[model samples]
Target: MRNNYHGFTLIECLISLFFISLFFLMLSGVFSQSQQIFQRVESREELEWQIFLIQFDKITEKGTFRDMSSTALIFEREELHEGKVVTLAIKYSSNKKYVYLSNNGGTEPILTQVQAITFDRQGDAILFTVRFLNGVEKVGKWTIP
Candidate 1:
């Protein structure tokens, strides 16, 4: 009498399972790396936003308001240079994508990666909203002194 077995050997089954587990391990690693990268980017964006707010506060607190528009604010600030008082005209404007600060006829970007910015006035305070390209919105109010 003879018998035939149509099944995988123990070694073959173990090898196949090892390969499947290795594939899953690699897949999990990819997901983990992507998640970490996303978190880093989000944190960096938040940090940039906080720094921008600080700068805005500093400029608005000590400067006299010259003009305010929907996307721009101009201020006249006095600084002492060489024992002489110099009046500086500073303009903060947003051009739909980023914020710029202009002084002495030169313009530089103060913040980047933004979608839009709006400025509104409420009594003695200025209300502003910033929208980032990544769908984050920040609202800030500063009182002119």
Candidate 2:
């Protein structure tokens, strides 16, 4: 009788390789998608930070103004030692409302958003907020003075 050996045939090796390659390809695709999502999130975060800084600077430097019926008035100043306050208010599009930043004396809308605006108060105390795209809000408050 001839000796019989059991082993994987050439077809088996090829099939195994094909499955392995396919798995690796799918994994690479998932990795690429994850990277893209991370980048997008980072970009959004950066944008939010930039917007906050700009709005803060404007409120701190220029003071605060309120506009009603196309009229503008300044109501607060940083030198009051009363501290500077900035509030971001968001309005819906259907209401034709705009976002406004209000300080001790005045309120002026820095920009309009369809969803939300984050508020950050600084000078004596600093406060921050995260306005999510989905209209969710998160607030952070700190004392600087």
Candidate 3:
């Protein structure tokens, strides 16, 4: 008499499950790492764009008034307060690897990781070159009417 059975034994079943679980674990880890990297890149880009917008807005707000030096840019804003004309200064300081804003006497940092900054007065336009910590350089020009 002869008996024949075609089936996986208990040990064979356990080994197959173990290998499949290990493969899924490694795959999940790779996927999670990739997601983290992508998020980091996206956030950095968003922050940089926000900084760029703020810089441009503050500089170009009134169209035609500024005092600029090698390391600083100042904008004078005048508004009627309590029936009296009040003048305010918005100063941008390119110091300590940051772009700082100061009003009255309070100061705040608007941008960081700056490598260098240059302000050039070209006729009626102000051209600026900003160098970032990652060795990236950006040039922007604004006309002061």
**How many clashing residue pairs appear in each of the predictions shown?**
0, 4, 0
Question: The CA-based lDDT of model 2 is what?
Answer: 0.52
Give the Cα error of residue 66 in candidate 3, in Å: 3.3
- Sorting all predicted structures by TM-score, with the top scorer first, yields 1, 3, 2
Q: Give a tens-digit lDDT track for model 2, residues 1-145.
A: 8969689989999999999999999999999999999788767756765685577565545544332121122234455464655443222222433455544445555434324433344555445554555454545443432
Each prediction's Cα lDDT score?
0.77, 0.52, 0.70
Candidate 2: C-alpha RMSD to true structure equals 9.5
**Model 1 stretches with alpha carbons more than 4 Å out:** 1-7, 82-96
User: How far out, in Å, is residue 125 in model 3?
Assistant: 0.9
Candidate 3 accuracy as TM-score: 0.58
Residue-wise lDDT of candidate 3 within 54-124, one digit each (tens)? 76676457433658886666776555464433333333454577766665567677666778878788998
> Which pairs of residues collide in candidate 3?
none
Better-scoring candidate (TM-score), 2 or 3: 3
Residue 9 alpha-carbon offset, candidate 2, angstroms: 2.3
